[model samples]
Target: MTDEHPQVAALLARSHRLGADPRNTNYAGGNTSAKAAVPDPVTGDDVELMWVKGSGGDLGTLTTGGLAALRVDRLRALRARYPGVEREDEMVEAFDHCLHGRGWLPGGEGTAPSIDTAMHGLLDAAHVDHLHPDSGIALACAADGERLTAECFGDTVAWVPWRRPGFQLGLDIAAVKDANPRAIGCVLGGHGITAWGDTAEECERNSLHIIRTAEAFLAERGKAEPFGPVRPGYEPLHEDARRERAAALAPVLRGLASTDHPQVGHFTDTEPVLDFLARTEHPRLAALGTSCPDHFLRTKVRPLVLDLPPDTPYGETVARLRELHEAYRADYRAYYERHAGPGSPAMRGADPAVVLVPGVGMFSYGRAKQTARVAGEFYLNAVNVMRGAEAVSSYAPIEEPEKFRIEYWELEEAKLRRMPAPKPLATRVALVTGGGSGIGRAIAHRLAAEGACVVVADRDAESAATVAGELGGPDTAVPVTVDVTSEEQVDAALRESVLAFGGVDLVVNNAGISLSKPLLETTAEDWDRQHSIMARGSFLTSRAAARVLTAQGMGGDIVYIASKNGVVAGPDNIAYGAAKADQSHQVRLLAAELGAHGIRVNGINPDGVVRGSGIFAGGWGAQRAAVYGVEEEKLGEFYAGRTLLKREVLPEHVANAVFALTGGDLTHTTGAHLPVDAGVAAAFLR
Candidate 1:
């Protein structure tokens, strides 16, 4: 964090690690832009909006693709949209529409907007944050809301009532703007706070400092904040206390966890109660979250507080709680009776909140319990501020129940709907091996035509440079003289490629050597040579590409130029077929590993893309004439008659297939061997 503002792109990725584990590992909550992408206010771009942490996403796992972009105007309009949406029936429709509607995603050029987009937009500050800090929420609930905010934040921050955090929240902010006019920043007592800076760096600096200060406050206030013997890993949340609850909750929690891989376990150290209690099976968090304004809608606010003392019977505790839980239910009915009307904030689900087992500690369960705690933490922090502010004056939210009705209603689910965004390949760098004169060159040209910076990697510098020169220069297409099999050359090519451009997104491992000789006719040297380029070389390039792609997390695609022979036997093609088959096999295994990291690996098998390839001009001319007993000139037409399409295949066709496989519409596809041949193998077999 610094005073110097960051670039429009800099905020997309940073080393900002604040949400470290209780032991030592550092995990982030989300990414933000405290520094504006646009430099000048008057002349600055209107594209500015505080891109904040999404409701669901791990900061450690965050990728450029995950950042949601919201425009300033679109955010302002959200305030206006909810006022008119009154009924849950009508409100839900609008909410879904808002989700479908392009609200403004800066980096999310083509992505589903975060569900909390409205919450972040409502903050008047230049940048806004919402994170689940284990330590932060521990303070949000210090008995008194406003006092805690002050105890931790002092007088610089303002405190607002927690009023279901979306459209209603924005309306509240706008109203506050209408009244106080100069209020710098405020926190939703049961949610989080918003702080602004004139610049992105200033914003991040302020946010980080504020968080650290809050941590310091907790240390001083808790009277138990000693680091002496307790560190993140060393000071484990009592595992024995949570054993049964953890065991019982595991099966039921998968729905809430969502991902195939959900972090579960009770180790000696860490946020023990939080780790287990957050995934409580009961609907307490959900009810709190869904009925009124709380983390219920997103995470459901019911916490399964399980700190059972050694003597208390588990059966008796559950029975008594069930019978007396009517207080929470009564509060809901009364709340609904008092404020709800056809147009007022409506309830969507049932839940229990504020669970307090004698030993387990306090918890607020919601759809995502971790999220619930974060919201509660934000609220608890502001509660302190409110207590201080209220001491001088009364504290209320930027009240607008009608707006809250829309944000918490069923309609908002539309914003959560997603069908993957467009690929980064839309406008970025693409490297294709053997691109000088074959399918590689064809793919390079096709990608360039599709608005990408293309790198044509080949052994022949003359042809590579010539092809590159014809297409354009470094900006469009550039030829790279690389011996793909050499690790030094591969690394050099990758480094030079990134240096030439800011980064690389697509790697087309389309280089290969083909020897069209029978198995007995193929020499060991020929086989080794073919495998070197077709298999080992491709892997080397892919390894380098994976490092870059994984770091960016937006993803990159690797397209291997294998042959249809890779999939099926091709007569008199022993060396080529063997090498290509190895390439195809590796593509499948690597896809699973790379996909989770945001990179994609797939292949294209073009049986005979000789039209615009080097093979057409060189090796094949002598061979085809001898094999067919016809002049070389007739070979192209003779080959055309032998396939399903019965039309000769072009290099561009194969290249187009590569582009599609790497692009978005087919985001779910991987481990695919798309055949670009005119069905020649099928024709020959039949």
Candidate 2:
């Protein structure tokens, strides 16, 4: 109980505070550490240990369990045993032996140490922080970075030349510290900042001082308009025009970004991004690529920038983007071949993670929504760095060979291999109409569980939002309000879905209304409303989604929740029955037409879902009961008794059929209808 406990807590607190602001560090881009003395469990003597942020952890959300603890003496002693930079990767595996009896946590279990562990353990300080702050990287990437470092902090901070991160780089920093006794930290050229102190508070202060001083240096001496003046043809569009343009281009860009694998998408048109894209030097700087490993790893070596003017014809603009996409993929493949060694990991993917559209915004893609969003953020950081460096001096990142090495490093491959397998629908995005309640809600929940990002669309905004929240908030689900009867609202809802999740890969047309009335009693408005909400609604949603799906060239699915009444003759059900029948027919027509484009269209026929149904609760139950001469409360039982299986259909049962129609195994079974009514013989598609 000496100062060890408090020191560990202090490390976490310091890490959190530093990481809270994006200006301090990008997501999961840095590490922090502390050295402490604690009593050894086996022996009565005090043992010195170094606790550092473990691999794959984000400092802002770090916990005690996310730390790796190792014996400081043992970590430093490896310097003598280190073969050289040639075999630095082997040292990572050796870290296991240095662990302090499995780990230093309560159960002696902790996260594995990251590659940056050496920098913390080898430093002769009680506390250390390494961060990828944009300001620091701005100076680090400057062509005259060493001179700028000296000018920015004088003797307070030292400069170290670019070197791949590993055990050797740690020793190099220690050497710089030994030479400059008054230096508080050192800037790792072409990388980020590393600072240390005798205490946690002092270490935090040193890190901030280095970051702020670099920021101030550039502000004072940097030239105006670092990216050069805004290009004449690339001015940002008006706000409404901008988002409209982004929505139009996102799916195409998303498709291009998914050349390697399916990816979710994120869009950002912040002032900084729009400003950068409007500048003349953006293309030049972008081609040079990002400096820090963290930036390029997430954003790719460089982004795919749209070269044409924003006001170009729509067809022309799309053609140019597709051309650029092909060139980017070719370039990426060539880059992989140029530097790949026998032992290097295989090229991960040829897709560009970030796409830059002049006047519109930036679009980034990843295997998940959060990952895509973070990639966009990291590119923003890169933009800031490029501006800062270009203002004071030329921006020059590490050579291409070095970037290739890091991107395909064997150790990084090992880390990726350790990740858990993805769920069935991991990279897919789904849009479910009427998803606020009943069967639609169940479909949203089921889709999210399979790892797809879900968009809940309903005329009721509140219910849609509530259902989306239940499905795990914005990360996994988003809500959009739409009245399917209005074409404009339907189009807007589809656009919102694209914005929320890059593009739609699955569409569920489930919104409907019911009226239990004889043909003579049914009014014209009733027929129109039912048709508008079911047949027409499905058509509008499917048509909009078809545009995106064809643009993506990726296979997709469309599911129609038709009713048994669509095929079975029923009493006093003329309007609702005709509308349902229309929907069932539309599904077949679309499946046949879109089959060439790899879009599967199918329908689900269910008996009256009396329980947990919005339609049933909205007076449909009592009306149906009266028509059948049964009590409203016993409607479900009556329906169940008529089915061969005698099982009442539930919302979840309908959801299961949707998944079955779209899930991987049903690839060849399109244009077919699946009955989820517990065996309604009359409704069977013969």
Candidate 3:
């Protein structure tokens, strides 16, 4: 086995963290891939199924499961068929085909392999791997190409000029393999490196070696300065036009270039980085090409930066692009004919071209669904470089002529990259109420453990402070002391959280009040208080959070912690049950109002939360234990064991239920009550 095998998981995680960022979409995004032992259904022997990166997985929490697997031969055939498939959705089904019987994808139905799936599939040696190494690319994109290549790869690898992806890239790689025979891997100029070995461990070793070498090289050259601080003035355009144009061009770009990027047609709103790239001095990014040519394989040769300045004519714009297209097509046709042989069906048709428009930035064009993670890291390096480059002289990427040549060159491009699909909640944030202890605390910890910034709020200042301190160590957590039942305090706390951490993305109504009594013994005051805490508290919190979240244009999550007794119609706690029933219905009403705003509201009813501190001890006390006729210590087991799971319901378990709702993962589920009880049939689904 190759040395890279053992460290496969670790390397994948490292690569992910180093590359996670949404901003890098403009540049080459990073990719996560693994070559693991998968038993072939036909032979029942371990056939190598390379799992490539899935879309939307930020690097910090990438895992083998996040990578999509494609049968290699089938992947290569698809690349041969489509010349530029980078930004197209039609190509998605090809990736999905491989997952028909595979259960690893989210929803466990069928899913597409990542756009980078092609690159991983194309590696033919013992094992193949790739990533957008920021430091490595910095050296690779430097002025002296040969020197940088030598410094990083140390003559062990070959260098390929950039080219559009698909058949062209795969064809180029095949030719290279024929020539080098024993090449470990090669560096796609201006792109990341491809490292291979007999096993994942060996591949990781080589990858690390290459990365370290490149880092050392950059250190010697005095690291980079900042890049494109272009002030992207907003220019509005038709959203439908952008989407239609983006979808149309995705496939062509993919076929033209061998990038493992997904098809990002267009984004309604542009981030600062996207805006800047779209408006930089050189409006024609692809004609001049990416920081290097290899990016064309992913991002297409050029992007259609939307809505240019008024001075640029709409008619003149189309004319200019037509000319550019003619030139690019002529060159690509010539190259394809030269490399794939005369009349080979693979080289028959479709030459890729770039589109550019003013103002909108390049989003109007086909998108490179890359690992933003990789590009983000590279941008950081470029920031240091661009700053220095600015001080020295105007920063020039590759020459326009060289860029075009590289963008079309068959001998330079890497293999077709197929990308994995994105997950529903990759970068979502969550906040839970009453996190000082019990279910709230457990839920807060659970969310944080899953790679989210969990905000723990509670009425108890000390407990809230302690839980917040545990999650972020004073600075990360914002502990607020406020009673949810009090409108003024609740409003103030919500305002403080928004000011502190932008806005609350997820809110859990884990804090509630319950009072037990015979119907005759229940006072109007007692009923009012319990109703205020459970019903009023939920409505107040949900209403406040929804306003801010809707204004931000990004939806949010809300979960109310209710009780099974509310659904089961239990005796001795009419007020508590009625209050919960009110809370439950509130979820339905809030969900209806909030859905339009992209906000979700739901509830989880727990039968026996064994660890609650305040009321359960004072009110129900041994009465709850009496239901099961068990002693204090065994009381929890008795209540917890009543469920089908035959286990006690811990605060941690209840917290998990809150975590799920607040995650906004089950988009189909809202206005519903999910039970955390072992297996009680208490919920009356509506």
Candidate 4:
């Protein structure tokens, strides 16, 4: 926790507080800086430097390495070279060249500075804070924003018209600071707020004071009328019908957003989303640009609107929605062509991130679930800000030209380009039963590495949590305790997965017990114990998963981890073999039933995988070794030598085979059983 400089440490603490509060800044949205003196690497003279939050790092979880330092004089002097430049590339290049000692200042070595560093350096203060507070943005986006600023703070705060952040913005801010020596802050019309002071505490205080002032002004106006009730012709549908309608529409939207290569995820609206979309003016207001420029980076400039009715036939509704989506993309392309000037980069994807359906509500789409949720949150916030602005005065956002500049800015585009390529299962959700250890644990880890959000479910609650923590903590892995034998617990697990990650796309049924006993020696309890988890658990989990997968309308996979003994039973192991055989047969039957709904049900029969398996831990390995007339220590080698591959099967080997069954290559193949027993000739199916 030690920092290279005291000022950097102070700034880091303050930035964390601001970032943790969603009202102050959403994910990775704001920037903060501190001015200090550092020794010059070559000249040995003291040079003034500004340490600002670097790009692509969240302020709430920022570290010393997240801030980049640049020479103040070098950044300020670049203005002369770009006197009338409209493009931001030249200015951004100059800023990079000014980095202290051709690297970072101290702790920051490989990070790039924020694009707003130039403006932050030009301000006349030791500490500066910039935030997109909801209250301030409400006023900033209002028609009479400048007039309201004058009335709220009088001359204590300066007001600057909307301008894309670059060389010109830095110059304008400096002039305003010089004209009003006593001013503590400035409000950027149709953008955000900036506050500075000699100390970090003073700067934070000024920011809070400005936000409270704006809030008081809006409160004085009283509550605004709720958006007029849904248009008269559009009646609200019953709750059951609404859910059914959303289910029917999700697949169409998913298909429209997908490309030829096809990587897309989606989430339907919640209660609050439905309420907002039910408003009569929702179509017009939602089509307008974002409340501020930063939001465009998440939600795009505008959301697509559709007039889908609940009673429409499914096939016709899908056809009409597809046509509308094409039109929306065409409109987006025209907007880009209209604004592209010389040297503008080629346009990116034209698909809208947010979509509004009159009867079903809004849906947000992204390459992953986390990203879709982020876009959804921004849209919700935009609704609140628009409502507040309209309450005080007409909502007047910045012109479209400014939005284009921000959206296509090279710095912003670079952030996306830097991310690594996604894996095949990236953003998909999977639930693995008995994932605390053995084959189940290996499968969970593999799926996570392939970019899926995993839910580790086990009857042993502690073990489930331990495995989940190892994968990626709570953000990427969730832990749920469920004895899959119980129908209620199985249903609850499905609901939990949906709550955690919007929906489930994959389910691994791998929980069971092994019992080897002679027919005469086998008690009724032994038979029930084996069958309860193997046959009954598989059925319960499969039924619940099918319900959710059908509701999502997106294709899914269900894999059952059976045993080689099921194919060829061994002496005195009738109970275990019988249960596994039941599960294997059920896979084919379920596959036949659910195939029409796009659900693929398959099974994997793996034998002699005793290296890290729970079956071995339960003493089954010792018992089998005794039966084979070998010592416990020689069991692994004995099994390896028996297999065609002459190698002991590991959990990872089984996991790889499971991935092959589900990862697109076998999309058309269902009700098929794959053997993962190192080429067991006896277990091979004809």
Give the alpha carbon lDDT tens digit for every residue of 1-686 in model 3. 21233435554655554455322222335564655555566777765555566653544456655556566656656765563534333455566665524443333422246445555666665455565565555544555544556655665766766644334454465566557765666666555566667665676666667766665655565524233444354343455444333333322332232222222222222443334444354343233444643354433334433334523554554445556545666775665555453422344233332333434323222222122222323333343333323323333355545544444433222222333333433334455667787778887778766545556778899998888888765224568887888898877676555433334567888777666677898999989998888788888877776755664445667888888876887767788889988888888888888888777788888876756644566546566555445676677777766677788777878767776666546877778788878877555453
Per-residue CA lDDT of candidate 4, range 476-580, in tens? 788999999999999878767765665678999999888767899889999999999999999999998887787666779999999888898688888899999
lDDT of model 2 at position 286: 92
Task: Residues 490-570, candidate 2: write the lDDT tens digits.
Answer: 889878988877999999999988889999999999888898899899999999889999988887999999988989999
Expressed as tens digits, the lDDT of each residue in 1-686 for candidate 1 is 11312443445443234333321112333334432433323455444544454444555555444554445565556455555423213432233343312223333232444445655565566655444332333333334656776666666655666555445655665565445544444545545444455555565555565556666665555533121222122222364544443222222222122222221111111253332233322123223222223333332333333333423565555445554444555554555565566754346433343343333333333222233344344333333333322333333332334334544454354444442442335446688888888777778878776667677888899988988887777545667899998998887677555434434678888877666776788899989998998799998999888766664445568878777777677577788888988998888888978988777788887866656668757786557556667677777777677777788888888988987897567887887778887886652322
Instruction: List TM-scores for all candidates, in order.
Output: 0.40, 0.98, 0.46, 0.86
Worst 10 residues of 1 by lDDT: 260-269
**Best lDDT among the predictions, by candidate number:** 2
Better of 1 and 3 by lDDT: 3
Q: Once superposed on the true structure, which residue ranges of model 4 sit more than 4 Å away at CA?
A: 1-3, 102-108, 226-275, 304-347, 355-362, 459-462, 481-492, 523-532, 539-556, 585-602, 618-638, 644-646, 660-674, 679-681
Measured over all alpha carbons after superposition, the RMSD of each candidate to the real structure, in angstroms, is 14.9, 1.7, 13.2, 4.0
Taken over the whole model, the C-alpha lDDT of each candidate is 0.54, 0.91, 0.56, 0.80
Where does the lowest 10-residue lDDT sum fall in candidate 4? 258-267
- TM-score, candidate 2, is 0.98
Counting clashing residue pairs in each candidate, in order, gives 57, 0, 75, 0
Q: After superposition, how far is residue 668 of candidate 2 from its true place, in Å?
A: 0.3
